[model samples]
Target: MEVAYRIHLTAILSVTCFLLKQGLPFRGNDESSNSLNKGNFLELLDWYSLRNEEVWKTVNQNAPGNNQLTSPKIQKELANACAMEITRVIVDDIGDNYFSLMVDEARDASIKQQMRVVL
Candidate 1:
């Protein structure tokens, strides 16, 4: 509930998402309950927090709550936010650049035509 704690949690969540996008494997759903104790990201964060005492006072103090960023709903929200952020960045980058898009039409086993776009 402290401002500092909120900021700390945000930073941790951001870093976790960044690593996740980079193809790193985080503990799956089954391990979410024990993430703080056994998860790699939290383990490393805990190790680093020891030296940076001012940034985070304690591991358990600002740790991710049960339904905070780890819950299924919250995870979907974060994924959507991340996707939108990526789309914005890509659109901005393409504004001044020339890019080619390809569209393909194919028939599926159900005899339905499907269109796919690649950029």
Candidate 2:
């Protein structure tokens, strides 16, 4: 899998598991079966998260600030790829000359995805 995608999936799984811990609805599973979805660097995230819920909270809640200080190059690369895909589909259907690519992004713990539209 792509590096950023791997990171993204890790975030998703972490959120899912976090929600599960906080009594969020999930598909269903047993801890004994060991079928949990820990996407990436599970050991490290688990260790850090266990050590500091406050830090995790800061990271989660203060994302805007963090992102401002963090390089979003990889994230933007993925977003750009998605946008190009959307643009390709629209241009195929309605030709490229008159269309514009518009992008919007949304995020929660469980999912962080970008939406693209042709206008």
Residue pairs in steric clash, candidate 1? none
Lowest summed lDDT over 10 consecutive residues: which window, candidate 2? 24-33
Query: What is the alpha-carbon lDDT for the whole of candidate 2?
Result: 0.46
Let me know the TM-score candidate 1 reaches against the reference structure: 0.52
Q: Which TM-score value belongs to model 2? A: 0.26
Worst 10 residues of 1 by lDDT: 67-76
Best by lDDT: 1
**Candidate 2 residues 1-119, lDDT tens each?**
24434443455445444544454333333322254753323333445545665545444444454342122353345445555776688779886466556777676677866455447
lDDT of 1 by residue, 95-119 (tens): 9889998999999999988888798
Q: How accurate locally, in lDDT, is each candidate?
A: 0.61, 0.46
